[model samples]
Target: MRSGNIFLKRNEVVFVVILSALLLVVFPMALDSFRLNLVGKYLTYAFVALGLVLCWGNAGILSLGQGIFFGLGGYGMAMFLKLEASSPEHTAIQSTPGIPDFMDWNQITELPAFWLPFHSLTLTIVAILVVPAVFAWIIGVAMFKRRVGGVYFAIITQAIAAILTILIVGQQGYTGGINGITDLRTLKGWDIRTDFAKEVLYFVNVALLLGCLLLAQFVRRSKYGRILVAIRDKEDRVRFSGYDVSNFKIFIFCFASVLAAIGGAMFTLQVGFMSPSFVGIVPSIEMVIYCAVGGRLSLFGAVYGTLFVNYAKTIFSESFPELWLFAMGALFIGVVMAFPNGLAGLWQAYAQPWFDRIGQRGAPRPISPAPISPTAAPAERRT
Candidate 1:
């Protein structure tokens, strides 16, 4: 079927406009800098939810360990920032005046070879984009070629997350331990801690999110999207149709990983820190919950779901920190059981039909048949 446009339908284009207005215009106008910054942090997670929709929702590959990619990306960004923060002037008190404090604290005299590339901003950006893609490709090739998938794939991802988290925590000298890489103060000679900087970063984050949304839309409407749907519904049929199903799966998995990594990098920028705490099993599962609550099949729903869940988490945790976990559990259960399609499903079922009815009423009706209809019925009955 021909599309209304190359990427989005007319209505979808309108949605993009409306969403942009809401995020870029309305939000800044209505919120204080602090609150707006909080919302920006929430938007970072939307990247992961968006990725989840791409892979799990569209491609039908459930991964329970997205935090691995998120952490890696954040760490990539953090490494660069930490190097900047650890200038000799700032660390002159330590035995090694140029190394990160955590490294110095552990009595390490030199930076690790792996961290050398992050000293250059160009290489840091490249590493941020490339590392996650390569890692995901490795995982995808290893598993998909062997036909390992479904819940097994999910459990394996979880195991990987656990392993990565342990490694980060265990290598305290290099990784900063559980405390995480901190004291992040600036980027490229700009003070990120300033109010103006936070506001700017918030807008930058929102812009990236909107761009990613368009990217997701493009992918979903493309031929590749159709193939992903087919794979999800009938993988064996797709394979028999001469499509290399594993390659498609591997490509999408890499795509999703990169999205998560981008979010992680942005999270580091806006939040000013990165930690293994955000890289473990719990955070990974929470990312999955964000997608599930948003209606994984709906790209827009995935984003809205992230905002809703994170907002709820902030408010609920503020008052009842102890009970927040239980509340989260219940919320997930309720959304799964009652609104299986999530908020997007509700809109389609109730709101979309209402709009359709309104449109029909506004449209011109056909002229009624002449009065002969009644006379013909009587004549036919008498005959």
Candidate 2:
């Protein structure tokens, strides 16, 4: 039991090594700038998938509004970037030169109070982390304390996403409306539009993702993780045991929200925009699909799933715009029906075992019964 804390299992260690190599070494050397950038965008979604693995997959909480957290994070970062890009000099043509262009276009003379904090990069970063977490906490506390969960909670989250999207769109002066915050130029004084910057951001994103993975792994191996699993499988039993199941649920939910937010912020940096379109029901469902398709129970599967689904989406949409949706729906249906554990499950069930068999065949076997019997007899006499 104590050994769980000291090290990851050998397979986990190998998995991490392979993932690091692929992300850090192989992909960078192989993919061109455009493709690499696209992969980076997909990696951002992986963050949400990782969160789902912890919250929904482990804790048995299914949220259909993850896109809400993602959008908030992206918008928080985008607000700062937009503010920087909307400097007096940059927006000299506008009547309100210092305010965001959307505000100026809407005939607003003064910057709203809420947008003030975003001017400082430090504060923006803080907001990126705090806002979604706070929002999630409120939602979690309200729902979990009342024993609202499963499909009802999912529906509530979806409603929240829809409401938020409408609010952002309706309040054009504040949120950039349906268009979302765009024309993000730089972080501090450094330009982020260049290919060099994208490369740097990709590496930064990967480092953050790896750090999150380790943290998730630690959680999954901890005592709290066991309790959480117990709560998931038998909430009443855990509750009868005097454990505050609601608190655990809230904690995981908020943690998942933060993860989604971080991904959103990274998405904005890499994609250069945050739109209400992404904050709605569809994107949130898409994120869940990513988690599901990757094997929700597997952390590494989340990333692989996000990439696989997004790549499939892009490829299918490019070649067969009309049939892409149908194709995607069919693929999802097939995956759920045939391989409920997603790609990760498929790998574990078949690929990993196949590889293990090959390894066993190649390895020399030394556990002969005659040698073991002779050695055991001598050791038995000494005992």
Candidate 3:
């Protein structure tokens, strides 16, 4: 039995590797720059979705504030980019250059002091990872220690994201106000507008996505992972088992936050900007929807969910922008009703047979089941 399980696990790993290679290598070659860029965006989201799978899918925690972490990471990178772009002599410049933009229209002269630290790439990257984790740690401790979960947890997270967006937007001088940060020139001395830099960013995003997926898998397979599953299945029972459930919950929460930050950082690097619009309550809900549509229980689901949904969004919003939300709502409903396991779940159910057939065609079949002999039946039963 153990041997059979090991074989199955190996097969699954091989399949995942093959799929990842195709996404990272094959698709970029075939697709145009615009399409590849869009796909890259989905891939970045996939990283965050994978993180959600660890926290919410396997661990049974419903967090809706992943966008906040994402925004923090994005803003971190944006701050650095903006600072790097800014002239050394003057403290502030036009938000979008030339016409003075909105802030210039409002007579703003200098950038806020907080924005100074972001001038350094090293500081920006560090802040991108640390800020989100810190926020998650604080919020997780406060809420989990007080025993918040389920709908309450989700609501609080959603509110937190909303509040953060408002704060960023209201802090005009510091955060670039409602306009946020835009018109980024370059990153680390490389021209962002160049195809070379774009391609580099694309590959970087892919690498980060792969890293995040592997890290989540590691956590999921660890001993603590099993405890998380136990806690998810029965929190009271897990507590009775002498584990500090709150600490475990907090740990997963923080893990998810860090993953979201990575995703966000990759996203801003690709798009070359950040805005409050990117991290509001709606985006937070959308992140949840991505996880739900993909497969709340599976990592593949989260990634596929982000990719598939984003693809659909691009198609629908372009063709029928007015009805995009309605289309999404209908699609969500359809998935909820017809594919309860999510798209990944559906793929698992149906695709495995085809994969097994291909594997079996090339590989030797296991030894046929030994026929039961009448004389040996009693001995076998006794053994």
Candidate 4:
């Protein structure tokens, strides 16, 4: 069994490496600027989906508040961008002095204390990880320690994301309100406005996505992964086996939060802005659907699912804006009803017959019933 697992792991690694090389080499050349940007966004979403797969797919925790983590990271990066954009020199040139547009519009004179730390790149990066980790830890301890599961946990997490959006919108002066923190000039001194810089951002997004995929794959094959799967299959059994199931859940939850935050930061940098709308309940649900439609246990499934669905959305929206949602809804229903394992699983199942055919070509066939007749002739005759 150990050897088999080792072989399987090697195969998985090879597959990932090959696919990554193919994507890096071919997609950029084939796709135009707009399509490449769209694909990059999808790749960012794939990172979020992979995180969800690690938690919900393997650990049996259907967290619906991943957007909160994503938002935290996005807002973290956005804050830094805003601060850099609003430096003493830039602020002097702007129409309004000593404040951003939203802050000025909202009649604000002083920057909030919390926004001060975001000025430093080091602090901002730390906040991006620490903020989401702390929040996930708190939430996980609160719910998992109490043994909350199923629909109840989902509802609570979804509510958390929902409330976050409202709070961010309500604090217009600090959080940019409904307009969001736009007019981002640079990311860590790289001018986001330039095509070359945008391309660099695109490559960064891909690298992060690949990194997340590899992390998820590693965790999925680790002892922790086995525990997660065991807990998913039989929580009581794992608990009875003397393992601290709640702690495992908490760990995976925190890990997923980190992944979401990373994805969010990449996404914000790519778009050159961040907004509450990007981290609302709708997006949270969409993230969940990405994992579901991709085949929850498959890391690459998450990537494929996000890319396929979002690409489809862009095309359908352009062609039929009024009915795009309806079309997407129908597509989701179709996927759920016809392919419970999702598109990736559907392809695997369909490909199995071909694989079997290939294997059969060189394998020896078993002899038919004639050999048994000598020993069983009397019994056969009696029968």
Candidate 5:
């Protein structure tokens, strides 16, 4: 196929434009500050779904511990904000005026060595990005290099998520315990709790999400993406073709982790807290469901899926409460049994064809082949 043809198709272009308009223009205009903030929160999950599309959809690597990376990035940012909010004057009543309130509550007198680095805004930003990537790299290298994959890999990832959640919840003073990191007041002297700050953060989140989408699109259209698919279908064949298949898997997994991390950081910024509630087995599986519901293969579909599922959750949980879990279970089962490729798959199978037909109708018809081709052919034969 021509290189130009490898990228976005007409339908895909349309999808991008429509989604962009909804997120950037329509959403801000239609929703109030509070609802718009909620939408922004949902968009953060879309980031996780986007990463899953690359890793699970294309590369066929199912990671059940994505929440670990998300938490790491979120906590990284939270640590900085927590520290800033714990300025000496802010904690003047405490014996140790410069430490976080939780630490002070636990009778801790000084900041931990690890928390010291987060005092710098630049370092905090770097840590938010790097910590998750590094953690992912280590896990990827260990599992992929050892040829561990499939269900086993998934189980191990789930276990890791469980462990991280336990660690965070167990260490009350250091990690804010079950409450997680709360009381975040400022971001480099700017009060983040204000509505205007949230609006700014929402735009920032949207911009970053779009940037991530473009990056994913580029990878999906490149030869490397084809190789990932090949490996997914025939791992041994790809390995025999002189490609270190494990390395590719590791790289893609790390890339996915980074994306999740970015989403986590944005979540912390917008939500005003980072909690262990988001970094555990249940949340990790839910993240996968978002990808699955969106059509794991479709990045744009993933965003819509995240939004749809989250919105439904809010509505159902508020009204039906007890039935929400059952409804969610049924929805998952329905998606798998009826539309394996998800909403995107349904669109491609039904809606896209209708759209194409409409476009064809609008196009100029070929001059009816100058009919009477039967007589014309006979004249040529006689000649």
Candidate 6:
């Protein structure tokens, strides 16, 4: 099959089907509400990994500030939730009953102008989608147009992440400081904290993830995607071919940012909070590791990689908190050194071939007619 025509190849389709079944059926069935909710949170990170597969893996843009966009989206939703939770009835004892609790605690008497729109669910949803794209566009225009990339681009992005973290933490009154915009209780009058709500949100998260995956697959199989690969391999050649490479880079970067933002929003909904801890250098870099471990080039691998790494972290950190960092560092090193293409690469290299061989061996074979024409003719004559 032609390359683009086979975006969802037979094997890939099977993999996706099985993964969907596991995530949508098996996991929900097996895990308790708490564990399942945690899985939902991890799946949010998978969103960022999927974006990295496009921006970093395909286009060769390594952003170390994706958490910024994620935080933006999360904060957007959290703002609305905070507003709902801080209604006049809920915070009647506070000095500013209509404002968020953090604002009141910090001695603020009124809500900020920016926080006004968040009171409207429609506006909040729009902000969740638009804010990150706009921010990403600004960054992309500044960097890509100037031909800034490689380690320098990564450094700049990391700096942006750091700056955002500081701003969020420093503005204690406005942003809730280190505590972040927490105690998010409701979404348009629906109590998000309820177990039933969590289950519904998990399904919503999965559906959105699947939609994003399909979109990513479409982009990956497009002529635009090929151009991205070309730019990654040889920027000058693509530029020489009359393509405005920066435009493509900008668009993909913004696209990736939007995806991260959506994930962040979902994270807030599922986890019930948004914090600056998720908007800093460490989390941003960790997000990259997820893509790396999943096979940066593989979208499906990104999801599994995120789940596997997070699952390991949860188990190991609970048992050996002090050694968690060491384990993570070792895991990163092992992945880079031994399986550069990650779990997906490993499967493609070793497991897939073995599976194919096994399939071939186990396939039903056609049986030849016994004793040929002479024996059949004698039997017919006797009859």
Q: Against the unseen true structure, what C-alpha lDDT does each candidate score? A: 0.92, 0.91, 0.80, 0.84, 0.91, 0.93
lDDT of 6 by residue, 187-255 (tens): 888889999999999999999998899899889888899999999999999999999999999999999
Model 2 clash pairs? none
Per-residue lDDT over 1-383 for candidate 3, one digit per residue giving the tens place of the 0 to 100 score: 12231122565477568768877778788988877877888887887788788888888888888899989988888877776666543334555442213345566655556766787888888888888889999999999999999999999999998899889888776677777888787777778866667777888888878777766766777788888889999999999989999999999999899888888888887887788987888777778778889998887678878988999898889889999878777877887798877877877899978988898899976897767777887879565
Instruction: Specify the poorest-scoring 10-residue window by lDDT in model 6.
Output: 1-10
Steric clashes per prediction: 0, 0, 0, 0, 0, 0
Which has the higher lDDT value, candidate number 1 or candidate number 6? Answer: 6
True lDDT of residue 262, candidate 3: 87
Runs in model 6 with CA error above 4 Å? Answer: 1-7, 358-383
lDDT of 2 by residue, 9-115 (tens): 87788889999999999999999888888899999999999999998888999999999999999999999999999999999999879989999999999999999
Please list the residue runs of candidate 2 whose C-alpha ends up more than 4 Å from where it truly belongs after superposition: 1-6, 359-383
lDDT of 4 at 220: 85
lDDT for model 6, please. 0.93
- State the weakest 10-residue window (summed lDDT) of model 5: 1-10
**C-alpha displacement of 323 in model 5, angstroms?**
3.2
Per-residue lDDT of candidate 5, residues 1-383 (tens digit): 12353577666677778888888999999999899999999999988999999999999999999999889988998999999999888999998899998898998888999999999989988888888888898999999999999899999999999999999999998999999999999998999999999988999999999889978988888889999999999999999999999899998998899999999999999999999999999889889999989999999989989999999999989999999878888998999999999989998999989988999999997875334545577777555
Question: By summed lDDT, which 10 consecutive residues of candidate 3 come out lowest?
Answer: 1-10
Residue 205 lDDT in candidate 5: 96
Instruction: Report residue 147 deviation for candidate 3 (angstroms).
Output: 0.3
Q: CA lDDT of 210 in candidate 2?
A: 91
Model 2 deviation from the true structure expressed as Cα RMSD, one decimal place: 2.9
What is the lDDT for 195 in model 3? 66
